[model samples]
Target chain A: MINLQPYENPMYFGYLLIGLLPIIIGMLYEKRFRWYETLFSFCFLVLIFDGPKLGQGIALIGYTIFEVLLTWGYVRYRTRPKGANKTSIFVLAVILSIAPLVVVKFTPLFDPQHPSIFGFLGISYLTFKVVGMIMETRDGMIKEFNILKFLQFLLFFPTISSGPIDRYRRFIKDYDRVPTKEKYLELLEKGVHYVMIGFLYKFILGYFFGTLLLPNIEKIALINGHSNVLGLSWSLVGVMYAYSMYLFFDFAGYSLFAVGISYIMGIQTPINFNKPFASWNIKEFWNRWHMTLSFWFRDYIYMRFVFFMIKHKVLKSRIAIANLGYVVLFLIMGIWHGETWYYIVYGLFHATVMILTDAWLRFKKKHPDLLPSNRFTKVMSVVLTFHVVCFSFLIFSGFLDKLWFGFR
Target chain B: MDNVRETVLEILSDLTGSDEIKANPDINLFETGLLDSMGTVQLLLELQAQLDVDAPVSEFDRTEWATPNKVVAKVESMQ
Candidate 1:
């Protein structure tokens, strides 16, 4: 028995490539070895959770069973001869599906030493998939439920840990059939390229920023600026940029691996990053950064909230409704990250900035002469957005908590 | 169908603050910065109100509804 967190090291990819070789060969011949793929996924799942993480392994199994039953029950109820899609049942299904994740998130607050038995790595990602299914089911989008396909989608080993969060419909499209020979070859090439980039981003750049530089900068900041209010220092600035780069490379790198592996298996998993730092506005930044997650929030949370407001006439002014939508969306995202003041503040901060950005955009629209849309302004906006994002990341890093309150 | 087209174009023009929506029926509203998530909501609401085409937000696939012509077609289909 061995435990290996996904994409944890370069060597892990060696093992991954070896396991995927068979699938790759099969795809080249325009065939899919479904049983072999299942076996490969099972073995990898064991390698990831069988050894020291047995508790989490057990938790994963139990969680999957519970979610499958819950989702299955919902689908049955919804499709049962002129379905009565009651809002109460839908809400209850969503809450029950997220209950384990809630417990896992809140466990530390109540008992610091023992994590919740319900806790496991990638619980949030799994919960996202489940909730998405439930919502789509409510909308009559997922009309039929098959246990095997649902299991495969939920436990797609490559992205089981963290995801570029593929949707049920999207995943099934690729899984149900093998790609054409040309398309499979193209996917294979892109998959290899993405994995190489992941190596560079995670092993080289992410290592430099996160493992080597971040700690030293943090130490200097603490030592130099502990006496100062809010512990501000030049080194703290360094920490901000370094941690932001590290965060991007590390998560983006992991996302690349997930997507690359998925592509190798003929599932065109959605990408998670797309030049996020180059974004010229907060809105654009979110659209590019950790894209799948943000898109999920946009589609599921923000859009839904806005529509709810409009439908219920919760507010008169559309601006106020949109602004409140940002608040709710960001606050939930912040709380999703953790139960910490810094995380909550990070969410609120984004919400505030989003509101302000909307105001600026509206004002610019009104007086186009005041804020000319030109190359210089575009570049400046990118620089400004970059720094704003880094500052938010600094808040997100929870280093400020350690600096001010002497705890992380 | 013509009425639906006119109504949709009117809404698109108002939401995007540009009359060019009627000129380029095949233009991608999203890529051209004409429609976004917010605009999509407004578009759906308008369609529901004016044309009685009730497409839910969850079913609004961006790709399928990207262009003005496609939007017009979709609205007509829903009718």
Candidate 2:
């Protein structure tokens, strides 16, 4: 039995390119082999989850079927003029869609000895897609739910593992149309370029930062930084920068591969990262980093909460409502990462910084003449924001937890 | 309608920190990054406070209120 994780190694790309050639050729001559594309997607899914990972394969299939039924049911109900379209029903559907992922997330935290039966590697990403489907249906954004299309979107092999989460309508637009000859050629060009960038980022630089430098830096930090007992040392700082680079390169590399492959398939899936390190503020950093997920959080969680707060007159101050929304959104996100103190702290740290940034912006608004915005100040702002973000990454690395808790 | 447009643009420009936003009446506020859902909340409040018109969030569809002009018309209709 042969199994391949998507973009796990260079050898995997060799197989991927071979498989993709037929699709590319078909696409060039104004033909899209839809059936073959589905088959191709399935074969890759099998290679990733079959064999020793059969358990996860079963879990993914069960999860997919469950999502199909739930979302399709909601869609059918929504289109009915007299059918029940209550908010409670929508909320119930949303909860059911995400219930599996919630169980998967909580399993290890409570019972370290055993994981959930419904757990799989990309369950979280799948849940995001399904939840989006349900929410959009309730909002009347999605007028129809084509089962086959939903399945294809849910199991889109390129982005199944981790996502730059694509919207159903946006994805359908690209999927349902074959690009013109000129446009296909452009996509081909960009696809190859994105893949090459992936190679540089994942194969070369990711290897250097994550596999090579990260462990060494971590060891030095643990040995020296731990001795301080107060958890402040240059070695600890070294771990922060190294881990941040490793995290950025590794994830960005994977996203490029996913997005590049989607482009080759003529689906213009969104790009995930946009030079996040250069952001001069936390809000801007979020827009440029793991963008799809953050934007998903922003649209679904943060904004929705603010609307709810204002609708009910729950909070009197607009600024207070915004800050409150940030706290709840990040807290939920923190819990989603894992049930760990470090993860929670990482979330809280960002929320606090964002609140500060908001307050500072408000202050700067009142004192426009007092605050300067020269090229030097712009450079300084970027530098300062980068370090503050790095400090948050340090909390996220869980190294401090290991240094403090694991040692003692 | 002109007064309504000026008020909407003023609130939007102040919220987004961009004076240039007021110039484009037909710009898709959400897509152009001039306005977001949070900005929508503020826009609704300002419309109510300044113009004595209620633009409820539930009624605020992106397509219906896609621009400053559309917003002005929507608010003016409530009068």
Best by DockQ: 1
Task: Give me the displacement of residue A255 in model 2, in angstroms.
Answer: 0.3
| Model 1 ranges off by over 4 Å | none
DockQ of each: 0.73, 0.27
Winning candidate number (lDDT): 1
Interface RMSD of each: 0.9, 3.9
Is model 1 an incorrect, acceptable, medium or high docking prediction?
Answer: medium
Q: Which ten residues in a row have the lowest lDDT in candidate 2 chain A?
A: A222-231
Per-prediction TM-score to the true structure, in the order listed: 0.97, 0.92
* Worst 10-residue lDDT window, candidate 1 chain A: A1-10
Q: Cα RMSD to native, each candidate?
A: 1.4, 3.3
User: Relative to the true structure, how large is the alpha-carbon lDDT of every model?
Assistant: 0.91, 0.85
Q: Report the C-alpha lDDT of model 1 over A7-103, residue by residue, as the tens digit.
A: 9966677788899999999999999998999999999999889879999999999999999999999999999997789989999999999999998
